[model samples]
Target: MEHSMYPSMTKELAKQRSDATPEIQAAFKAFSAKVFADGALPKKTKQLIAVAVAHVTQCPYCIRGHTELAMREGATEQEIMEAVWVAAEMRAGGAYAHSSLALDTVNQVKSRSGA
Candidate 1:
């Protein structure tokens, strides 16, 4: 079996982590429950958003967990794929937008060389 730098997320590991900090764990659980609860946005919508954000954040665990959750919350495969595309666009857009830094350096170098 290939071992990864990131350990597999198991319920036992989760319990061990939570056992180390029960109070914080409870608080985090409450926060997660509240965040996932239906509000102005339905659970399905939230899960889709989570899926997109997870992709952008590059968290494999979150991608799997939230993809499952999104499905459970009635998000279709098409919708989940759309969300991934959205994330891809946003991630690419960020790099595209930040290319201004390279442009700035180019202009600066050109000015210094009087070219």
Candidate 2:
């Protein structure tokens, strides 16, 4: 396996975490279950959204897990790729939109210098 910044998910580590914070773990599990359950948004749509969000969040584990869940929910490869493309655009768009801050600073400097 390739080396990763994140540690391997050993059972020992899982048990250690759970042993330390059993209540929190249980609450988190319940929250995740409720969030993923079918409601207004179907499970498939949720999984696809998860895949997209995972990319935006840059979580490797979530991306892989959600992509699999999305496929099991009948999301096609094309659909997954398209979702990724949407993520890419949103990521780029955030930077593009935030450029207004830099531009505003430049305008402030120009005004101060009377240029």
Top candidate on TM-score is 1
Candidate 1 lDDT, 76-112, residue by residue in tens: 9999999999999999999999999999999999999
Give candidate 2 misplaced runs (Cα > 4 Å): 1-3
Model 2, range 59-88, lDDT digits (tens) per residue? Answer: 988999899999999999999999999999
> 3, model 2: CA deviation in Å?
5.4
The lDDT of model 1 is 0.97
| lDDT of candidate 1 at residue 112, scale 0 to 100 | 100
Question: Taking the candidates one at a time, how many backbone clashes does each contain?
Answer: 0, 0
Q: Highest lDDT: which candidate?
A: 1
Error of 2 at 76 (Å): 1.2
Q: Weakest 10 consecutive residues, lDDT, candidate 1?
A: 2-11
lDDT of 1 at 1: 96
